[model samples]
Target: MHRTASIGLAAACLAAAGVAQTASATAPETPATYLERIAAIDDAGPAIHAVVAIAPDPAGGAQGGAQGGAQGGGPLAGRAVLVKDNIETRDMPTTAGSLALKDNATGRDAPLVARLRAAGAVILGKTNLSEWANFRGDRSSSGWSAVGGQTRNPHALDRSPCGSSSGSGAAVAAGMAWAAIGTETDGSITCPASVAGVVGFKPTVGLVSRTYIVPISASQDTAGPMTTSVADAAMLLTAMAGTDPADPATAEAGRHAVDFAAALSGASLRGVRVGVLRGQAGTTPALTAVFDKALADMKAAGAEIVDVAFKPEARMGEAEYAVLLHEFRKGIDAYLAGLPGQPPARDLAGLIAFNKAHADAELRWYGQEIFEQALAATDEAVYRKARQDARRLAGTEGIDALLARHEVDVLVAPTTSPAWPIDPLLGDHFLDIGAGSLAAIAGYPHLTVPMGAAEGLPVGLSFIAGRWDDAKVLRVGAAYETVRSARLAPPSLRRWGE
Candidate 1:
C-alpha cells in the first residue's frame, strides 16, 4: 500500500470505531466542545495516557470564561493547549509524573501559564510526563509513570513516546490539543517530538522561567513548545518569553524576545549558512533518505550547506548524568521546603521510602536506582567538578568549537532515527542517531522540525544554533517547514481493542 493510503485506511478504521463508541459523533466538536470530546476519547480509546488531569470546566473563569472574546483573540485564540504536568498550574496539581507529589496542588500558576492566559489560549489540561522528568530511575521507561500510567505513541499504539515530556508530544500528535508545553533536561522534549512526529523546541536556558515549575536541574531546565508546526512553536515561544521576578535566569530574556512570526519571511533562508554534521548517521535507511531530502531542500532554497566532521563528545553523557543526579537531590528538597502543606514525599529519602511502600504503584516497571544514586552521594565537590567538566567538553570543546571552525550559522542533523515499534514489556528500544547530545550537555538551544515521513513514521531535521541564539534556530526552522510543507496528522487507531 502507498504510505498515504495506509495512513488513510488507519484513520478511517479508527474513526469508524470512534463513531460507534459515541452516539453524538456526527461532526468534529467546536474548540470548547472539541476539548471535552478529545479528552474523553483519550481516556477511553488509544488509552494513550496523554492527559494527567482534565479541567472539569476548561472554559471556566480560570481559563478566561465563555465571554472572554473567543479565548483572548491572540495569535492562537481558540486553540487548546496541553501543559506538561511538571509546569505548575494553580487550577490543577503539578505532579511531575510522580506519585510523590500527586496530590499537592498550588493555587498559583507558573509564570508561563499566566503568560499563556494573557495571550488568550484556552488552558486545556495537564499532560502526563516521565516520573520526575525521567530522573528517578535507571532503565526507566521513557513514558511510563505511577501517576499518569503510560503514555502510548499515537503512531504505534505500543511504542514509547520518549520523555520526560511524553504526554505533551503524544497529546499534540493525537489532536488532543493544538499545541502543548514541554520541558527538557536533555533529550526529553526533542526525543518524544521526533518519535511522535511533532515539532519540539528547547530554548536557551533562560528564555523561559523555571520558577513554580518542578525542577530537575535549574541550570539546564527551560520550558519550550511542543507543537505540530514550526509556526505554532514560534507563536507559543513569543507568549512564553520575558523576564519574571520569580526566575532570575529570565532577566536576560527580554533582549532575546523578538516577533518570531515576523522572522518567518519565505525568503529568509536566502544567503543563510547551514552546516551538516556528517558524523551523525540515523539508524535506518528510510530516515537517512528523509534527512538527505531536507539537506537538499535547504540547499535548493539558497542556503549554503557545509558538511563538517564532528566527533561525539567523550564521556559527556556520564558527566551530564552526574550533574542531573546531584541537582535532582538538591532541587527537589528545596522545592518541598517551600510548599504550604505536608508534601506527599518530603525529601529524597522520604520519596524512596514511599516508593518502597507502594512498589506496585511506583516501581512496577523500573527501580529508583537513579534516585538511590543521587541519595548515596555525600561529596558536593565531586558533583561541582562533574558539572564543570560536562560544560567544558560539550560547550567549549564541542558545539561552540565546531561551529567556530566551520563558520556556520547553525548545525543540522537527523533529530532522531525512524520510530521504533512500540513495546510495553521491554520499554523504548530507540535506535536514533540523536543530535541532542551536543546541545543538551553544552546547554545550547536545539529545535526540530518535521522534514518528511520514513516508511509511515515521521522524521525530524534538527537545527542546532549558537548559545542563546534560539531566535535564529526558530527563524530557520520556520522557513524550512514552510518550504517543506509537511503537516502533522493524528494516528488512525482510536482504541487498543481496535
Candidate 2:
C-alpha cells in the first residue's frame, strides 16, 4: 500500500510537469552536421579527442536517418547517442580504450545497444575512455589511453576529464552527441559526468544489463547515461533498462521501467528531508561555497535538511579492491574468450604481455600493477568474503543507516571537487572528494546534477537514495534542478585563463 501510494503520487507529480514521457520533435539536423560540429570541437579547435571512432550508419553509409520515422517511432527515435568504448557496438571496435583490442569488432551489440536500436536511436560512435577503465595501473591518468590518446576537458584543455568514462562525459559536454552510454564501477560514470559539467546517472545495479561489457567488479558495475540534462539522461536510461537473460544481475530489471523524466517536472523539494552527507567536502572554500549555494537553493525550495554522520566500513576500500581484482579476471576472461572474432589477447596474461611488447605505446607512461595483481589473485574465499563485507558496509550500514536514522528520503553532497589540471608525468592528482562510494558499493542509484563552477571548472551536487528507488531519486534531483538549472555549455578549451 505504501509503495502503491508513492507510485500514484509520483504519477500525479509527472502529469503536472507539463511534457509527456515521450520527447517532442525538434528541427532535425543532419547526422553529418553533428559529426562536423563534434569534429570541429574535438579534433580541430582544442583537440578534445573525445570520440575514438564514429560508427557507420547501419545502412552502410555515413549519413544516419535523422528524421523521426513515421509515427515518431520511440522517445529516442532519430537521436544520435555516443557510447563509451567499453560497451560493445556491432559495427565499431570495443577497445575499452586499450591498444590490445583495437580490432575487437565483434559484430554483436550488447543487449543495451539492441534496446537503443529498438527505440530508434542512431549509434553515433564509440568514445575514448581510460585504458581498461582506469583499472590497469595505479599511476595512470584519467583520460589518457594508448588507443585514442588523451581526452582533454572542454572546460579547460589542460584539465582532467575524470574517468573511466572520460570521453563519454567530455563528448556529451561538447555537444558531440545528444547523450552517451557510460559504464561505472564505483565512480567511473558519476565522477566524469560531474567534473565535465554534465548530468550523470548510475542506476541500481540490477536496473540494467551488463552482458558483453568489459567488467571490473560484477558486484558494482552498471552502465548508465551521461547527458547535458536530467531529462536526456532519463530518456536514455529508459531505453537502456530491461532484463537480460544472459546477465543474472538484471533478473529484476523489467520491474524498474518507470518513466524517469516525467517525474522531473513541477517536482518540489518541499516537505522532503535530505540528509547532508559527511565526507570529503566542506574542506575547501571553493567547493564548500558552491555546495552551500546548492543547499541554499534546496532550502529556498522548501526542503528540510539535516546533518548526518555515516561511518562506512573502515575496510570497505580494501575489500572493494580485493573483490574487483578477483572478479576482473573472472569477468574479463569470459568476455574475451566468447568474442566471435579473434581479439589480440584472449586472457589477462596475454593482455599484460601485449602491453610489454608494445611498451613504447601502451606501457610508455605506467605499468599495469592492477592487472598484475588481478592475474596473481587465487583466493576465491577472499573474493567472496570481501564482496559480502563490502556490500554490507556500503548498503545496510552506509546509505540505509543514514536514511533510516536521519529520516531522510535522500542524501546530498558535493559530487566531486572541481576539475584538476591534467598532468601527464604524474597522472591524475584528483581531490577524491565525491560521495560516489556509498551508492556505488551499495548497488543503489545515484544522480549528479550540475551545482556550479569553481575556478572555471564545474562541480555537481549528488542525490543518493535507497536501492531500486531510481524514480524517486530522479524526482528529488529534478526538484533541485527545477530551482537551480545551471547546466552550462562546455568551455572554449583554447582560451583557458585569459
Candidate 3:
C-alpha cells in the first residue's frame, strides 16, 4: 500500500494544523505529502526557505512509495533527513550556498552519507546555509545564501536563524524534515540549533567524518544532527559515527562508534554534578528566568548543581580566526582538488574571482573579507603560532581546566540569547558567541537542547563535555529533555513584528 496515495488527505489535514504541525504523529504522511508540506512551509506561506533541493527517494521506486524509502528499515528506517548543502549528496549538487559551486555534485556520497544510507536513511534534500558557512565576510548574515536565499526562523519569521547550520536548524524546527545534518566549526551547529529551538549536537571532533563536506577549519569542522528532539539527534549521530580512511579526523571515531541513541540511559540526575557557567548566560532577563526554572527542575530531579568559573582567553579570538583562515585555505584546496567533476571555481582564488565576476548575485550583500584574510594567511608561518596558542588555551587552559577544577561531569550554560532579527545590511548582531566557541576551539563535544522559550522565541540549554565524551553530553541532554519537555511543534504561522 502506497502511503503517498493519501497525499491530498495529508495536505488537507496540515491546512488546519498549519505548517507548524508538519511532524504529524497521528497520521503517517507520504513522501509526496512531505514534499507538499515542505513547499507550502518553506517556499510559500511562512516561507521558511529551509531546503535547497528535494531529491527523489533513492530507495523508493521511480514513483515514490512509502513502504521503504532510501533509508531502509533500520535505525532511521523510513525517516527522512535534510543534509546541509556543504555535506555532499551524490544525487544533488552540494553548493554550500555558493552559486560558484552550483555544479559541484560529485556523484559519490560523503562517507557519512554512505553510512546513513547503509543504515536505511532517506536523503530527503539539501538545506540552505550561510554562504561559505558564514566565513565569507566580516559582517555576514547567518542564513543568506545565493542559491537558496535566506532561511527564516519558524519561531519568528523576521529573526535570524544563526549560521552556518541555519537551514538545518530551521528545517527541523519547522518540521520540514524528520531530522537534518549540519556541520559546525565554531557556532555553526549549536548556535543555529539554539536559536531555532531544536536539538543540535556537535560530537567530539573525531566522532564523525568530514570528508566531502565544504571546509571551514579542519581543526573544528564536524557534521552533526539538528533535530526536533535529542533522541532524533542521537539516532542520526549513530549512523554518522564511524571511521573513514579518506579523512584522518575519523581515526578515533571507531572507538566511539556506538549506538548513541540506544546507549542513552536517560536516567534521572541522581548524583550528576552539573557545573553551571552562569557567566555564559548573558544579561537576558527573559532567558534568565527560563534558565532559572530549568535549574530548579534539575534540582528537583536530584542533580548536584554548582557554579563554575571559566575566564575567556584574551588572545583566543585572534589565534582562532588565524587558525581557521589557515586551515580553510589548505582544506578547501584539497576538497576542490578531489571533486569528481570540475567545479566552476576550482580553487579558492578561482572562487574569489568567480564571486567577483558574479558579484550581483553572490557578493551583493557581503564582501568576502574573511576569504581575503584566509588567502593572505595561507602560509604555515602565519598560522602555526595561532593554531598552537588556540588549542592550548581552549583545551589545556580552557575546558579541560574548568572540568578538572570544578570536579563536574559536564558544563552547562545558555546556548545563546534568543534569535536576533535578520539584518542584511548590518548582518548578525549576536553577542553571546562564547559557549559554542568554547567547545569549538577546544575540539570538544557540545549539545544544545531546548530549555524553553524566550519572549515568543526559543531558547536552548547547552551541554559541553570533554573531548570524545559525545555519549555523555547526549545522555545529559536526554535527561534534561525528559525534565523540561519544553519542545513543541513549530508554529510557522506565528510571525512576530519588530
Candidate 4:
C-alpha cells in the first residue's frame, strides 16, 4: 500500500542521512552535539520517537539562503531549538505528521523560524506531532503519526504525551533539545506541557506570526515556546514576538512587543491579586491536593487568592467547534495552494481523498469524521455568527468579565489532569477540567508551570491574563516559580506506576 511505502521511504531516508550519531556524556556544545543527544535518546536508547527529521547541514542548503541576510549572533547564540514539523523549515520537510505531506519540503522559512535563526538558534530538526495536528479524525490517538510513529511521554513510556504538540513537549522534558516551538489552537501546547512536566506559553494570538505555519483556526492558532523554565520561555518570546507583513493579525505586535526576558528581574507576587478558577481544576483528590499546595505557595508569596466563578454559555462549545471547522477549510486551502512543487494534496478535499486512498496508514485507528465535518462546513452566515458568538463567550463575556468583576490582575487554576494511559482503541482521554480553553478561545495569553506530581505523574499550575497581557502573565509565573516547590526534573523512561 502507498502508506506502507511512504513509511519505508521515510525510514530509508533517515538511515541514509545517518540521523543518529555518536553522543557525548557531557553537555551539548554544538548543534551536532544536540543531534547526537537526540540520536542517543530519541532513536536508540529509549526510542521516544520525538524527532521526525534531522535537518541536513545548512551550508549550501536553502536554509542559508532563506535567512535573508540575518546573521546568527543574537541573544539565542549557542542555543539549539527544535521546531514542530507543522512549521515549515527550508532545510527539512514540513510534514504535519501526515504521509500526504511527506514530500512537502518548501524551501522557505516561516517568519518565526527565521526570527529564531536570526537570534542564533540552531534549527535542530523537526519534532513529530499528532497526525494532522490531531484534526483529521475524531478518535485519533495523540502523538500517533504515520510518518514518525507515536511520540511517548518520557515520564512514563506508556502514557500519552498529549498532542498535537506532543513531540515538542516530550523532547524538552526528556532533554532532547534546548527548547522547542509548539503551535496550539486549544489544548495542544498547554495540555502536553502540563502532562509532560515542562513550561508552555501560548501568547496573545497576534503576538506571534502564524504565517507559513499550517493552520487550523487562524484566530486561535499561534506558535509558542515549550521549555524547561519560565525564564527560557521569556527569552524565546523576546526574539519571537514581532510583526510580519504577511500576517495581518500581527499589525499591532510592534506596539506590544517588549524585552520579555528583562521583565523577569522585577517580577514579584507580592500584593498581586490572583483570581482562582476552582471549577476548572480536575476533580481527582490527588490532583486537588497538588493544586491546593500551589495555592498555598502563591498565598504565602503574598498573592491575594480570590475564588471566582465561571460558566461557559450552553452553545459556546458547539460554536467553537464550528468556527474551527470553517477556519480549517479556508486556511488549509490557502496553505496547500501556496506550497511549492507538486505537493500531495492541494486542498482539504484533496487531503480527504488522499487519506481515503491510503486508509491503511491514515485511517487504521480512526476515521476522518472531523475532516468530513470541516469539508461540509459551507455556511458562511453560520460561520460568521459562530465566530462572533464563540469569541464573545470566551472573551468579552468570559475571561474579560472574570478579570473585571473580580478586580484581579490575572487568573489561576490547575492546567490539567496528569498524563492518561495511551490507548489507541479509545484515543485521547483528555479530561474537560483545565484552564486553557477560555484563554485559547479568547486569543489571550496562557502559561503553565510545573507545580508538583499526583501519584508520581506531573501536573501544572496555570497563569492566564487578558489579550496582550503576555509580559504580566510571564512576570507572575516567574515570581511564583521562585516561591514554589522545586521544579520537576525530567523522568527516566519506565513502566507505568513504577
Model 1 collision count: 4
Residue pairs with clashing backbones, model 4: none
Model 4 lDDT per residue over 105-177, tens place: 9999999998988876777789999988899887788999999898998888899999999999988887667
The TM-scores of all predictions, comma-separated, are: 0.90, 0.92, 0.93, 0.92
For all candidates in order, the CA lDDT equals: 0.76, 0.80, 0.80, 0.84
Which parts of model 1 have CA positions greater than 4 angstroms off?
1-30, 61-73, 485-490, 494-498
Superposed by TM-score, candidate 3 places the C-alpha of residue 419 at a distance from the truth, in angstroms, of 0.7
Candidate 1 lDDT: 0.76
- Highest lDDT against the true fold, candidate: 4
Error of 2 at 473 (Å): 1.1
Candidate 1 vs candidate 3: the lDDT winner is 3
Give the Å shift of residue 62 in candidate 1: 9.0
lDDT of 3 by residue, 68-161 (tens): 4443456666667789999988898889888888877788789999888766667888999998899888778899999988888877889999
Instruction: Name the lDDT value of residue 35 in candidate 3.
Output: 67
Candidate 2, which ten residues in sequence have the lowest lDDT sum? 1-10
